[model samples]
Target: MDFDKLRESCRKISMPPEMKSRIKTNCKAANADEKQRSRTDGRLVAVCVCCILLLLGIGLTYSGIFERKLPAASDRADASKAENENKFAEILSTAKLTADRIFETTRANIDETEMSSKTQTQSQQSTESTVPEQTTEFVTNPFVFPNGEHAANTGSDDLSYVRPLYLEMSNRENLIIAKEAAETMSQEDFDLFLAENQSMLQGGYFHSMNAGEYLEFTQREWYIPVAPEDMAEICWMYYEPTHEKIDLGMDFSETSKIRFDINETYKADYYYKDSNKYRYEKTIQRDNATIKIYSRRWLYRFENFAWKGYRMDITVCGQEMSAITTEMPLEELEKYLEMIDFVTIKDWLS
Candidate 1:
C-alpha cells in the first residue's frame, strides 16, 4: 500500500535480455539508413516500453480493487453477532425480569416458613423437652432410598411417619372409605388382628442398641410407598441401626444402589451376622389377596431391655402398593391392607 515503495519497484523493472538484444539489432540497422528513420525507430521503442508499463499498472490495479471489495471472515462474524443481539435483546430482558421476580417470591416464602417454625419451636420448648426438628436432607445406600421429596415436617417425632397411601386420594369419597375401613377395626379386633398376622412387636421399645454410632432412618424420618394416586403403595424402605458401614452419598458410582421402584421385582441382597435371619422372603394371603414380603429382622439391646427391629418391604398384590414398618404397631398397616383390598372388592374400592 506504500506508493513510494511501489514506484521504486517499478523503476527497477527492465526489458528481458533477448528482447533488448533484438531491439538493439533493429536500431543499428535503422541508424545506417537515415537520421529521420532512426528518430522514428527511437520513438517506436519508447512506445513499446510505455505499453509494457501500462499493462503492469493495469494488472496491479485490478488485484487491488478485488482485495478491497471482499470483506474479511472476522468482519462477517461480528455482523452476524450484532444482528442476533438486536433480534433477541427485548425477549431476553423480559425473561430475566420474570426469573428475578420468581426468585424473590421463593426466598420470601422460605423466610416466612422459617419464622413460623421458630415460633412453634419456642412454644414447644416452653412446655417440655423437645426433640429439635432437623431440616437437613440425608440419603444413604440400599434401604434408605430417597423419595426425592423434601417434607418440611416428616411427622410427629414420637410416632410412626407412615401415612396410608389411600389417604392421598384426591376424590373425597376415596378418602372417606379408606379412613373408615382403617378405623373400623376396634381396639380388640385390632389386637386380635395383630395376633393373627405377625403384627405384634418383635422387640422391645425405647431400647438402644450397642450400635449407637450408626444413624437410623426410623428415629427421625421414615419411607413409604412412592407412587401416583392410581398406584398402590406396596414397598417400603427404611434404615435400621446396624454395625455396618453407613454410606451417606459417598462412593456413589461404586456402590450398587438398591432400587425397588414401582413395578420392579423386589429381590435384593442384604447382610447380617445370622444366616437364617439375614433375609426373609414370603408370600402370604391377606383378605384373600396374595401379598409378597421381603424382610430382615434384627435385635438391639440397651442395659437389660432388648428391642426388636425389622427392615421389611411388603408389596400388596394387584394394588401395586407397598409399606415398610418398624418400632410401631403393624396392625395399623394390616388394617390398611385389608381396607384397600382391590382383588375381591374392586368395585367397593373403585
Candidate 2:
C-alpha cells in the first residue's frame, strides 16, 4: 500500500478520451485569456505614464519654470514686482520722448514768432527812413515903404525892386557927426567962458553954438529934415529890405501875448561886466497879423553919474522891420513906436 501500490492503482484507473481532450481545450483557452489581459494591463500602465509626463511638461511651460526651478510665493511676488518695475520704466521712457517732442515744437513756434516780430519792426523802420523830409519855399514880393512917397520903378534891369534906405542915409552928411564935433570943440575951447556967461549960449542945445570960424554957415545947412513917416520907413528899410520877408507862420490872436527874455534867447551873444547893467526884452501880439516889439536898456557909469540909453525894435508880423537906439526916455520911445502905421504894414504882410 505504499508508493508502488498507489502508482499501479492510478495507472489502472483510465478515463474517456473525449473527456480528457475537452479538459485540455478548456485549460488552453483559459491560458490564452490570461495572457491577453496581462498585455492590456501593461499597455494601460504605459499610456498613463506618457500622459503624466505630458501634463508635467505643459504645467512647467505655463508656470514659467521650464528653464528654472519652481519658485516659492515670496520669490514669485518678487519676480512679478520686478516685471512691473520694468514696465513702469518703459512707460516713463515713452512719456519723456513725448515731452521732448512737445518742447521742441513749442520752442520752434516761439522762435518763429520772435523772428516775425523783428522782421516787422525792421521793415517799419526801413520804410520810415526812406521817407523824404518836407522843405519850405521862399518867394519875394514888391517892396513898399511907410511913407506915401514910392520908389520910382525904373525900366533898367540893373535896378533892384527895393531901394535900401541905408544907401540914402549914407549919401547924406551925418548930423550926429557935425553935432559931436561942435560939442567937442566947445568943451575944449570955450568951456570956462560958457560956464561964466550962461546967457551967451543962446539955446541949451549943443548944436546951436558956433564951433569955429567957417567960410559958410547956415541953419538949414546942418539940418536934413526928415518927416516922422519917412523916418519910420527909412528905419524899416535900413534894418530889413522889403524883399526879405519871413513867413514863420506863427499863431497869434488879438489878446494873445508873447514875451521873450533876451538873456535866455541870445545867451552867447550878450555878455556884460555888471549883471544889472544891460537887459533886453521883446513882446508880441496880433490884431489881423502879428506885431512884435522889443526894448533894450543899458547903463554906463561915469566919474560921478550914470548914463542910461534905450533901444527900440519893431517888427510887422515876424519880420524885423525897424530898430533905433537913443538916449530917449521910455515914454518918448513908446511915442515913436505909436507913430508907426501898423495897419498899413499888416495889410502889406497879408
Candidate 3:
C-alpha cells in the first residue's frame, strides 16, 4: 500500500457524518469562543479608553485646564476681576474723553488764531487805504474905515478887534484920598461930559460920532447910555486906542498882531484941577513886528457925591498930545469886577 493514500483513507473513515457534525459543532463552538474573546478584548480597549478620558476630564475639571472658565465671584476673585474690568473701561473712556477735549481745544485755538489774523489784516488794509484829513484855511475880506486913518483885513466874516480900557494900581484908600482933593460936579454935568465923548465911550470910529461914519463895534447900530450910575463916591478912569487899525492880512490866523502892554504906576502927580490929588499914569507900549507905538493915559478923580462916575482921558503923545475923553458906569460893573482876576487877561491873550 501507499502510506499517504492509506493515511488519507483512514482519516476519512474515522471522520463519521455524526462525528463530523460533532467536530463541526466543536469547531463552531471554538470559533464562537474566539469571537467572544475578540469582543471581550474590544470591550476592554473601549473601557480603558473611556477610563482614560474620564480621568482626563476629572483632572481638567479639578485643575481648571480644559474646564469652562469660571466667572468672577461676587465676593471673591470674580468681583475683583469685574472691578478691574470696570476700572480699565473707565481709564479707556477717560483717555478717549481727554483725547476729544484736546482735539476740540486745539481746533478752537486754531480758529481763534485765524480770526485774529484776519481781523488784524483787515485793519491794516483799511489803514493803508485811508488817507489823512487836511485842515482848511479861511480868508476874510478887506474893509476900510471912513476916517481913512485905519483899515484892517481880519481874515474872517467881519472886522474883530479888542482894545484895553484902563489900568490902575491905586488902592481904594488912595482913590478915596484923591476923591477928596479933586473938583466936585453934579450928575447932570457928568451926563453932558459923557455925551461929549460918545464916540470914545461906544468904542467907535471918530467919523461915526462926528458926522457920518460907517465903522462901529458890531457894524450895527447900538447905543451906549448917556447916563450910567457910578459905583464909588469918586473915581478916576483912563482909556486909549494906542494906534489906528492897520492892514493885518487876508488870512491873519497865523499873523503876529499888535498888542498893548500897559504899565500903571500909582504916584503923586499934579492934576489940572487940583495939584494935591492922587493921579495914575498908564504908559502903554504897542508893537507889531516892524514898529512900536506909545500911548499914555492920566487919570484924575472928580470928587462929587452926585457925580460919582468914572471919567477917562486918552492921548497919544509922540508927535502931538490931544485929549480923548470917555466914561463908564463903574456901579454896574462893580459886582463882576470885584471877583475878576487881573491875571486872567494874560491867560486869555495867551
Candidate 4:
C-alpha cells in the first residue's frame, strides 16, 4: 500500500472501548499518585511509547502490511511516537500552570483572612482602652448629744453648735476663765488642780463638764438656755441659714458643759477693742425676753504673730448664756447665732 493509504488504514483500525477507557484510567491514576510513588515521568513516557508501538504493530499485522511494507511501517511508528511525546509535554505544561494559579489564589485568601482577624482584635482592644473607670463619696456627721442622739439635728435649724463652740473655747478668753478660777483657789489647791487635770491643761483646751453642769446652765431662769434637742436647730438658724448642713462629728457628752481655757498667755496689744469696727453686736427683743449678742474680732499669738479671729457671746438676762469662737468674719458668725430663741425665767415660770 502507498504511504497515504497505509496511514488511513492505521487510523481506521480502532481499539476497543474497554482498552481506551483502561488507558485513560491508567494515565489519570499515574498523574494522581503520591509524589513519592515509584512512577516517574521517564517511566510514563516509555510506557506511552510502548503502547503506541504495540497499537501500530497490531494494525500493520491485521492489514497484511507488516510483511510487505515492514520498513515503511517502522518509519510511521517512529513519527507517531514523536507526536505522542509532544502532546504529553503540552498536557504537563497546562497542568503546571493550572496548579500555580490555584496556589496563588489560596495564598491570597489565607492572607486576607489573617489580616481581617488581626484588625478585629485591635478594634476590640481600642474599645476597651477608651472605657472610663468608676468612683465613690462618703459623708458623715460627728456631733452627738448626751441622750445618745445626733447633735446634728438637735438645734432648731440645720447648723450644729459643735463648730462654733469649738472655735470659741480655743480663744485666749479661756485663759481668763482659768485665771479667775485660779484666783478662788489657793496656790497649793491651784497646783493640785493643775496636777489633777494635767492632761487637759497640757492639751491647750478645757476638759468637758458633766451633764449636771450643762443642765444647771440650761435650767437657769434668768437667761434663756438652749435645750439639747434644740441646740443644733438654734445654731443652724444663727449661721448658714441658706447653706447646707455639714455635721462634723465632734466628741462630747450629752451633759457636756460649755467651758473654756488656754495654755498660753495673750497680751492686750493683741485685742481689737473697737466694738463697732471689729465687733458685731445685736439685740433681739422678745415680748418677755431680751437677747444680746456680742461677736468681736479677737487676736491671739498662736504662732509667731497675732492671728485675728472672732468670738460670739450670747446672754439672755436672768435666763441663760452661750458662747462660741471661730476664725470666720462677723457676718458669717452672725448667721450661726441669729436663730436662737432666748426664753426668760418669767416666760418659763408662766
* Candidate number of the best TM-score: 4
Which structure among the candidates has the greatest lDDT? 4
- Any residue pairs clashing in model 3, and if so which? 72-78, 73-78
Off by over 4 Å in 3: 1-28, 51-59, 62-72, 75-115, 120-350
Q: Show where candidate 4 strays beyond 4 Å.
A: 1-163, 167-190, 198-277, 299-310, 326-329, 332-350
Please, what are the lDDT tens digits per residue for candidate 2 over residues 1-350?
49999999899988789999999999899999989988999999999999999999898779786566667978876775555455435434543553354335434544553455445445655777432121101010011222322222221122222221110111113333333343454322222222222211211111121222121212111211221222222211111223332211121111111111111211111123333533344443444334333222221110000112332334554564533233334555455444434554443224
- Per-candidate local distance difference test: 0.34, 0.34, 0.31, 0.36
Q: Candidate 2: RMSD over Cα atoms?
A: 48.1
Q: Give the per-residue lDDT digits (tens) of candidate 3, residues 1-350.
A: 69999899878765568998999999999999999999999999999999999999888788968756566545555564454455435434544554354335435544554455445445655777432121111111111222322222211112122111222222233423322322243322322332333222222211112212222222112222111111121122121233233222221223311111212212111123222332333333322111111111112112111111222222222322222211223332333223223232122222
Ten contiguous residues with the weakest lDDT in model 1: 198-207
Cα-based TM-score, every candidate: 0.21, 0.19, 0.20, 0.23
Predicted structure 2: clash tally: 0
Residue 101 in candidate 1, Cα distance off native in Å: 0.6
lDDT tens digits, residue span 1-350, model 1: 89999999999999999999999999888777778777888999999999999998898888685565656868865764554444234323543453354335434544554455455545655866443333211121101112322222231232333221111112223323322433565433432332222101111111121223221211221111111110111112223322233332232222212221221222212233343642445555665456553331321111111112222333344553322223334443344334333342233223
